[model samples]
Target: MTNATTDAMTDATADAPLGRSAVFTILTTGYTGSTGPGVAATVSYVHDGDRHVIVDPGMVASRDRILGPLAELGLGPDDITDVVLSHHHPDNTMNVGLFGRARVHDHKAIYENDQWTDRDAEGHELTPSLRLIRTPGHSREDITLLAGTTEGTIAFVGDLWWRPNGPVDDPVSPDRVTLRTSRLRVLAAADVIVPGHGGPFKADETAPV
Candidate 1:
């Protein structure tokens, strides 16, 4: 691990994955549906073939619902090596402090050159993976990571789809004109679609993208 200074951020990591391409595993916290917002507090993790990264921890839920299930997966809050947040929203970032020594990553625009958030105050590596894309429709900080390893180019659209049951909410996305088009674009590439919450799905599945 390196320091959090700007000097520490090298170019994006372009190394090809060594294992069976790269596998991303997601562990969800819970779902939320209300008249105002239908978002779910879905947290997840991905093993980039380099190490483990828990993307978002989400709001406090039943221990069994959140951390306990992760513990069953041979992971605990402490085992999370890195946390990459989609945005600084309260639902996605509330449990960040649980990472302990784990590093936290967000776009430079999200956290700047600072080290440490309320959780894992010693966060580092704003851009760890290669081909990280910045798609800022959901929020100014929204980012998507693209990996071109043998796994067939995986793309992680932070909160772009929240949960992957649908691509982009057609109504709220770009006046709803481009929602279906964007979802097809996302489905064409990437073998696996890993959302911010719940489990991953094959790119062709009806699951969220």
Candidate 2:
């Protein structure tokens, strides 16, 4: 893995191709203040051949923050084929309905229309380039989405680090030990990480242990 400074990492991987044709874009970078009244979920978009995926389309200052970028890419809500939630937290799932045509993937199963298909997310591949891996930390059901980009593996880890530097200790994590284990697992496999409440960053020694 090439050790890159955070800025260089983001610039390097932003347009990196996934597998042969997959690509991802951060629709909106999120933020959480020390306290009251300021929080937003970092949303992302992934496109791999037939799959038009939206990752963590949650709370934002406004819906336009999500849609505007999609429009720029020539997409609308109806164009999305899948929606993957890192976990079930409302902040990470509230805007899912915007893409009612999409099949939703969570830690447990796939939901589309009225059909609910039960399956473990671990090792589940939405495509050859994009897949899911169970990494419970911020929440017991949390899962990370991995995309095989040319730059390396990019992981969309929901709240796993909160931001690149991390909280060091997740104030809300149910299991600190498990969270640490998961963090190491992600760092081992991913070259870049798109955290739940922040922008993308390189996964390197600076990642919280």
Candidate 3:
């Protein structure tokens, strides 16, 4: 139940012991080739024993940065069991196809696919331990993945808000009320919050108003 920041895969491996599922945040700087806002994005994955689940594989532009780090950790796309998309936003789900054997799961409202289905108002459990809660606001299909890891409940919130610029908001959401309520639920539920952009933070310090 320790938390630490690492820039290299080597450092993370040395610091984390086996059997203790660790969350690794792979930061991929946003595009800046004169077409988009260039907002930086993050790719997170949970390393649980031999099983790895990727949350928000990030955009295709970050293919190497994301895959390279996984390879260094002795994991490839084939090793990933689940590709959980917090939402269908390009920043969060564009690279999902890269994981050949991984099953892609997302809010069914986003797409009518068999791989995943929409949950009830009470939400649904993807596994005996992991729960996928539908928390729309940032997007109609927005959802949060809650997993009880060694570090406590880690919530992978896709585009809930941008945190790098000091408590920044999404700036543009379809429904403000729904978004507000969603944020509150996540803040109350998670001990560690991993946003769609920026690094992970303690839920208390970044509580939503």
Candidate 4:
């Protein structure tokens, strides 16, 4: 089950005036197996005005898992304007080439074609309703994408918590303490969370602290 956390970032969208709506859909729900090699990245689609964003289009059972959902939403790869990678792990980046025409956003900067423009990710606004914030933990370069959707703020956090029923202590995090701190920060800002390897869930008391 999912949980609900306090809303500590209502002001984040104060500047996002009315009528500007950002909507999102979970294209694929990822999973990790206890044995064997089964795994996939949870992928998401976000639309804010003219921007069509694909988040974490990583390893899937098949590319159709990502594309089929987009097609159902009336969008194609060429229609995607941006792609956001929460971190650089192959599971979170392997399918990046699918959107060759889109600009890519990582923890560091925006990349498009052959140009890699470097910039800090903290509070970087992709649109008036979506932004990026540094939340390094599972990896020193990890970042979270915060989207102000009609349902409230949703955070696409990579590996911070693999799922709602989290691996309370991240097994691969370089700094457990830092991961916990980042978790708290994300819990504060997000009303809903789309974890790296699972379906989206509400942020609440059950969140790892």
Best by lDDT: 2
Q: Please give, for residues 1-209, the per-residue lDDT of candidate 3 as tens digits.
A: 12221122223222112222445545353332222566545777775544477888776455787888888888788888777787777767778777878767777632223544444523555454466777787788887877666777777777785552323345567877667667766766667777777667787744553
Candidate 1 ranges with C-alpha deviation above 4 Å: 1-20, 34-39, 109-131, 147-154, 167-185, 197-209
Each candidate's TM vs. the true structure?
Answer: 0.63, 0.90, 0.74, 0.90
User: Which candidate order results from sorting by lDDT in descending order?
Assistant: 2, 4, 3, 1
TM-score, candidate number 4: 0.90
Better of 1 and 3 by TM-score: 3
Model 4: lDDT of residue 48: 94
What candidate 3 gets wrong by more than 4 Å, as runs, is 1-35, 109-122, 164-169
Q: List the residue pairs that clash in candidate 1.
A: 97-119, 116-121, 164-207, 164-208, 165-208
Candidate 1: tens digits of C-alpha lDDT, residues 1-209: 22322222222222212233445555664454431465456666566545667666767554355677678778877676767776667777877777776766676533313564442211223334333344454555655555444556565665566555643462334434233333344555455655554345577756542
Off by over 4 Å in 4: 1-20, 34-36
The local distance difference test score of model 2 is 0.85
- In terms of TM-score, which candidate is stronger, 2 or 3? 2
- Worst lDDT 10-window in candidate 4: 1-10
- Relative to the true structure, candidate 3 reaches a TM of 0.74
lDDT by candidate, in order shown = 0.53, 0.85, 0.64, 0.84
Better of 1 and 4 by TM-score: 4
Clashes of each: 5, 0, 0, 4
